[model samples]
Target chain A: MMSKFITLLPEELHASLQNKYNEGFIYLLDITAVDYSEYPQAKEEAYALVYIIRHKSFQEHILIKTYLHTLEIETVTDIFKGANWLEREVYDQYGITFLHHPNLRRILNHHQFVGHPLRKSYPITKGQLSYEVDDLIDEMNNRLLSKNVVCRLESGSFSECNKDLMFLNLGPSHPASHGTIRTYVALDGETVEAAVSEIGYLHRGFEKSCENHSYNQIVPYTDRLNYCSAISNNIAYVKTVEEMLGITLPLRAQAIRVMLLELSRIEDHVVCLAAVLVDMGGLTNYWYMYNPREDIYELLSKLTGARLTNSYMRVGGMTNDLYEGFEEDLKDVIKKVQYGVEETLSLIKHNRIFHDRTQNVGVINAQDALNASMTGPNLRASGVPFDMRKDTPYYGYENYTFDVIVGSVGDVYDRVMVRFGEIQESIKIIEQVMQNLPEGEVNIKDAAITLPHKEAVYNTIEGVMNHFKLTYEGVKVPAGEYYSSLEATNGELGFFIVSDGSGIPYKVKVKAPSFTAMSAYPDIIEGSQLADAILTLGSLNIIAGEMDR
Target chain B: MEINTQTLPLETAITTRLDDAIGWARESSLWPMIFGTACCAIEFMSAAASKYDISRFGAEVVRFSPRQADLLIVAGTITYKQAPILKQIYDQMSEPKWVISMGACACSGGFYDNYSTMQGIDEIIPVDLYVGGCPPRPEALLDALLSLQKDLRTHTYNPDRHKDFKGLLDDV
Candidate 1:
């Protein structure tokens, strides 16, 4: 077993990485940008800090460092191939350049985009569309604000002069391309020679929105990131903040977090598997798998007030105790979903179309899979025995026993099989948690951060004041940086947050596994037919919100 | 299987100019372009499935290419980057087309307060009807379709309709 390293660093450490750090292997987890206008002179410089984690043996952990300047850093793509997309993301969100990186164009936005929308300096509200020719003239003369960047058209498509390659934009609107994100593929007919994924067609800059709101106020925003599994997002954010505050949730709260995360895993995998089935031309299986998924959503909604972005987990604990009759409702939902899962498995597990479509298509050998930095089902499909929940337990995951499912053939079918196996495993995990339900306070009794009882607030004036202050101003996290990762529905969802001991976080950066998995799309689509391309894309289950964030 | 007399007679020929117009309309039972942008797109998927069964109204075949489609179902949020693509799709579609701006985000940007999201998709393209709800239920999406069909039956194919609807949200 490799020792997990969690090193906290000051600004001087940034210079050390630039000058002397040469690794056995280095992986840039994610970068978080912070506004420093209000901080003291020592910390008053706007910076983007990235967590560089090293992977070894069965366990993987990382060290942290903060960078003061947005100067172009040496591309880590040459070192740890996984850093390619992470560096591009830093460029996209913070306008920080990463030198010596190939294909450094915008990954999330259009090429001719004006501003880095994720930066705090950018205005939050939408501006009026200025059509006056005179306004353009004034801007050209440097007499007025630049209106061109607000609502502008980006020109230039791929050139036809290059006979060797052609560019195809895959579905900002196309059926196979789920939602609004598009992948610009440079191809020689069916073979994708190279690819650039253009995201931010759905970029809402969720990180920037978190700055204006308080800690508790930002749970809804996390919901939109990976809307397929909002519970995972909630867990990541709350856990990271919990680390910063040194707040330990009660036993019941930890168990509830585990239960919710497992259910979310089941739902996320079901939809992904069903969608992949449809992509492979097995519609009957798609509909069959989806029926049980509907039941899961119903169960989720009954437990929490909202279904998708449950906001169930709070900083210290949950929004409220589980809704009454949740146990009975959950049991029925579990029973029906189990039946639905078996029916779905039988429908497509032996089907000819599914086998033919997925077996040999988009094969990624284990070495290439590691090189491309694939994770979750995709990496497991390539026969990598890695699962965050099993390997590195968080939020009571280690207490439950389950297999870390792996596959031999790293194709679409193997990925499906991994998710299918994991869904059964998730059910096993949830079942255990339900039966061995821990008896304790649902939330920490600390009233300073969380609100006191409604009765207490109504009767006592201090309780009322505590509630108001916590709601409006939010809880102040201690000044420090904390890194935490949870086994999200997709893969490892990590949060690297830097707190300035303020109500609002200095920076909260999300490490979305789907986004990293999406970086390999161009590689997966190479030499495949157009329809196969759709199958691989859907099978990957790349979420645009997470990708573009 | 015996055919019901209540079912309309099947016509094989679509040769004449008049027949082409009527036949296209019959085919146009309004083919909805899958404009699924986010979570609401899930409900849109359920609507197209066997249970809700959108094929009952003869509008189930979703065309991947916009050139073949006449109906655009705006299923979720229209972000700033997504706005241009949505407009381009609407522009590529044939005339006498209808758009169902489904869900709150497509209608008015929903809970999004960021600069990246467009307030309403109608600012970029014309919408025939708006379906409300976080994700409007399948029944709501079906209602939008019925409403669009009603409007389509009343109005003939008009070239001027495109120009009138272009950049439509001036006063509203």
Candidate 2:
């Protein structure tokens, strides 16, 4: 296992966590809990709260686990501001209460939902519906009054207001947002006094669903994590499972996987850039961006079976080999994509309107961003050059020569420009993969992991038996636990898996990047203009499927 | 109140039933209120792209407001948390409106039938069409629009009340 687990007492969690943070563990990767009450190997403890922290310099992951006798523990929110939502999610799922945590409410499930749905005792099909909307009036009012700001934007003067602070609800079904995020902002004139966003509208019990499903069946569910870059989620899930099974896929599979990862990365960036631009009243960019994106979809539809959600990864390898003449088509698409990117660049690079709107719009200082545990391009946008591909070197990323794109101000402009820079670098990586494409069997030779051919199944009794056993029992993942992550579209989309020598996983907690992004949203949007807030939200690319999942 | 066909020029002259003319008008100039939440939203964007231009049907004007829109394309999964919002949006749309449930998830909750996800959105709101696929392709969305258009072309309207204008209450 990549992660070294350290058992801790509940009393020592706060002190030890502070000690580690002092010892250069600046990044908070994820906070999740495992319900081991029903597991065969578990001891007397009913709940185990796991905190995965990392060193600021590199990917030195440490898994600190503390078993809770009861459902209460000290909150680490004071140390890590991002722990607010992470703790709430843990509490919502496992019913492990965090003591002295401010505003510890249901983060993923509705407030009306009863019992922690992720508990082994909770029924999978028992669902509850909430009729009343949770207006975060108390929360937003405090944040607005506590700040006590006296001034406004640098160029504009702050006028004394006669009217009360106007509360505005922007989403949960607004046109500006992605239709899942709801933010209630207290506005003074056009400036936002305070804002509180809520998610979980699309929380379709992904973790609960993963527990009931076998390893292979869960691939399709991961496809919806960040549907724009679906394959990256697939790779993130399958890679963890593959590591647990100790299977080394052929070199050909690794090359193709990297290629698809870069391709999807481009696709994700294009969608983000185009959508944010359209928010700024530039619909022409959507045409330019989506044209190449649609061309990429054309190639992907041929590569995978589906257009949007391609569940193309198996345990040890890709579902199938790449079609012949794929390189020609891929190269052609890349050229067109580059041209489209250049057009958008010429239109946006020195444009006055875009610069004025995005330059200092939603600024989050590097310290606040790091405190909130932001990762990927968002972290990199704040001038942090930490990339999983570079730091961890998964899928032979170290072998490729490309820059880890960074930005200075960490505003909306930097965020958009960083994605544009990354799309170019991804093209470079894809071209490198195509140049030295490996030639070998995609799947590993292990009969236990790979499915047999149709001819073999009909002709041989061994094949029939093996297929049946693998179908019913699933690929036998040796009883163990591992946390593996990849550089997904948003951030470090990690899968923390616990297996118990059974067909189903004991627990598979997704460390979705967008969740962390949402945790940092109120901080980013506060004290900014409402119009700029909309642009900032779009620039953040808060995909609800991934955020809620 | 009939026009004189002999007085009108052949180029501009046309004759059709009022119901058929109303159906054609409703089908042609559809202002779609897109209720997209997940992957199908991305596909909807693809349909807005050049390869599969949805503007060709005169349905390009995607009004986020329920009051302005005539077609409701409910795309992606709607969980219990979002059920009330979906119902409110459905209720807000005016009469003579149509609903097209766009993906498997919207049609029957797709593969996610668990504690959080609803079995189908139809449990809360009536649907006119159900496009199938994990996220039915951009072309498939276009096909559903066309099918809905076909239904609207022959839909029997009753001015008296909503009772006579029977919807496509089939198991979509």
Candidate 3:
């Protein structure tokens, strides 16, 4: 449905990607593939790799498709550094070999995992064992050799290389890791000489689940992807499906979506800042942050039935109309959260210890951040003023008046500061949504797309069948593919859906933000102190549910 | 029934069966090691935070290391890749420990019955209690701890014996 859907041969995949990068299409949005082996419609090619790249401002967007004869293709990591993880993931799922890929082993699955699960030929429920810890020492030694630092590890000998330098496991269960990521760091006294981050501990096969589930059933899955802000993920998933269907939602539904979206963004920022502050040893600010999140959660629980995973967004529109006096509750919570944030942050924002731990410790410039495909608050903190809401302008975001907040320094402090500013701007957008509240039915007018009312269901056979089919099978989307992204809490939360003119999607590739952000961890953490590395990871806000999905 | 014999632990002298006294002591101060891996982690924090206040029930000393913890609260989804680590943690915990499998995923892989996901965390490590929800609410998690506490109140001391439980496939 988007522009520039050109097909290329595997031989030209590398060169074409290079040519695009040379022409200022530097922002590599995503690299995903669909296994056509299992599509309902017969296809010539077994697989088609889709590349989404954009210029700096995201004005001239390009989505290229390349068919593969075999499960082998040239790796594009040289042109786009962000292609490293994306390529590895493709290799992991589709078993497509990325030639010259730096570390192209299993990423989402353990090495013990046998077959590529994403391929249609592969069985869905064939479980595997997850033994064997990853070998990060070889890579650590390689980096140390490049640095000319004395390599403590000599032929796998644990001969007390140096008392000062040691290997430490920072997570997967540690307090600072927020219980998900495992960072293996070779430490030189207090400084980290090399680090290798191992994720996928929470890879619960979210995309594979999408392959079997209906469009509506996947909403709860999206909520788990970014649990901090469930609605944003919900919006991204539904927006992609709605785009494929070519349906325009009612004005009131759009307004309500924007309202919940901004509220979710504020909640996400609050949680990220709270966790980051906790990592920085500012424990008091956590309650200050969490209290506001609880308020938002309470508000959402009333609107939707669930708290953390609110499956509130239907494909065509919202599930329910806004309750009466909802506007008053929204405004009151916004005021309370704003005041709470300002009052609590003021205590530690200017504190010397906080500044010392965060400032200039994990510095990343704009170019490097963009090259790594970072987005949202982290990329903005690196001084890029790119926002999907402003540039792509989805769901009537253009009408809202809010600045794209940027920071000069790309460190923990700047990331925190950017989140703080963005929270205020989100509040501003929510206020705007309140001002432009239109009165109308929330669900669309079409009966086939949306379920009929209870009264209608009880009275007519058509309504009864409609309710039954719609409830169980979900709305059928046309046979086409669309890549839709939105500015989620962490970054660009993208969903690339390949529909087969049925309820079940052919392939759903989530270009999750935390995955890319966490991929850039080793690059920025090597030269920093051990303490700063923890703060840097927390600042990135790598939700394992999203990253490992 | 008296839970603690005295305000100061050293000066306490109480007459009771070894099992009853030890069980009361174990249930009263359950040091929980949270193996949090997904959305359920957030709920665990809420339960641990100011609102739910998990410390009120004595399982609030959140420890990451298994050796120091008396209870293993497996709080989220345990995938195939993460199952070994979960088993290692469960194996490394101090003796007389209990495992509270939290969330639907931890109990039975929830909605994701896929290639990479373990059918349930109990497939790798034995479980004492299972709480069900996509992500069980904070209250549900608290109630799980309380329910585990009721079970813990009858724990008998055994130096050479472990819980008589085995996984479906424990080799991994």
Stretches > 4 Å off in candidate 1:
A1-26, A32-35, A58-60, A66-70, A126-167, A186-189, A457-460, B1-28, B56-58, B149-172
Model 2: per-residue lDDT, tens digit, A297-414?
Answer: 8899898878778999989897889999889999999999999999999999999999999998898878888889888888889888888999998878888889999999999999
List TM-scores of chain B, every candidate.
Answer: 0.79, 0.84, 0.86
Models ranked on TM-score: 3, 2, 1
Local lDDT at A28 for model 3: 92
lDDT per residue as tens, model 3, A105-159: 7788887777898989888898887576676777666666666565445586443
| Residue A11's lDDT in candidate 1 | 36
Clashes per model (N, Cα, C within 3 A): 1, 0, 0
Candidates in order have lDDT scores of 0.71, 0.87, 0.85
Clashing pairs in 3: none
| Candidate 3 segments exceeding 4 Å error | A1-4, A150-164, B2-14, B154-163
* List of clashing residue pairs for candidate 2: none
Give the winner by lDDT: 2 or 3.
2
CAPRI-style quality class for the chain A–B interface of candidate 3: medium
Name the best candidate (by DockQ): 3
DockQ of 1: 0.30
Give TM-score, chain B, model 3: 0.86
